[model samples]
Target: MASSRWIRPEVFPLFAAVGVAVGICGMQLVRNICTNPEVRVTKENRSAGVLDNFKEGENYAEHRFRKYVRNRTPQIMPSVNGFFSDPDLPTN
Candidate 1:
């Protein structure tokens, strides 16, 4: 067995937390650089007309995404209550 004389295990959580925070910050920074309307680093981005941006925003607003379950309450154990309560369920 090789004896370890390196970093302490107690500091592992701190390191993991720092890594997660750094990763989140990095993702947000990249997203802002790519999508933020005010950021016009490229020539094409700078040349885009205001009406084009307005149309893009309108396109996004007009398309509404649908959820899977409509007019239904969310449940932690989805089938448990239904299985016990359904009158027509087979009981053999």
Candidate 2:
């Protein structure tokens, strides 16, 4: 009668910790999906479909870091973005 489990009992704590971390992340994701204004669509706006106004400026941020950096220069790589987008291309 070889009654030995393949998964070692010593690894239970690791599995437990991982499970807790995953559970917490899942809970926060679900909460955000359900309650966040930017995520949830209003009943009146449902009919608008693709044409609905996003009003991104009025949406709530998930963290203070985002709120603080909102109006600041948002370009990740301004040089790349402005490659051919320059305003002064006096005809050659």
Candidate 3:
């Protein structure tokens, strides 16, 4: 029983280290998913759908224009204006 108690104490740190490693890995995975281009595009698409649904007039041309403006604002403006920018910005 005394020997078992000593072993348990020794194993506690190992388990704690494993838990920390797993937590770090999970955080990294979440960060990667949040920053992924495909994930960002999907989120943008969903946001546009929500915005389109809320518009009062239901005009297709207006909805398209709004989506285009929203999508282009961060992407096209900086590139054309020569603002310092990351080259990996999503194109699609």
Candidate 4:
């Protein structure tokens, strides 16, 4: 039973290497997201109009995303036509 509880020494190094690689990848993804200019611009544009006032160093992405969503129409459902044929619909 004692022998069965052990991991092979060679396998430990492989697991550690994978962990290190994943950590590095995560760090790079964070860096890219934080530093991208287009993303920052889009966010800024949506939050405030192109001519709106701004405070120094304020992030505008949230406002920009909100404005963009507000200006777009909601998607129409294709199944709306089926509602007319429903048996429960009144003919009047």
Question: How many collisions per candidate?
Answer: 0, 0, 0, 7
* Stretch of 10 with least lDDT, candidate 2: 53-62
| TM-score of decoy 4 | 0.37
Better of 1 and 4 by TM-score: 1
Q: Which residue segments of model 2 deviate by more than 4 Å?
A: 1-6, 41-92
In terms of lDDT, the poorest run of 10 residues in model 3 is: 52-61
Q: Rank the candidates by TM-score, best first.
A: 1, 2, 4, 3
For all candidates in order, the CA lDDT equals 0.68, 0.68, 0.60, 0.60
Task: Please tell me which predicted candidate would have the highest TM-score against the true structure.
Answer: 1
Clashing pairs in 4: 43-60, 43-61, 44-60, 46-63, 46-64, 47-63, 47-64
RMSD of each predicted structure = 6.9, 12.8, 16.5, 13.4
For model 1, residues 52-85, the per-residue Cα lDDT tens digits are 5776555444443324455457786767777788
Tens-place lDDT per residue, model 4, 1-92, is 76655577867888899999999999767755665433344655557644433442245334455777786557465346546556676565
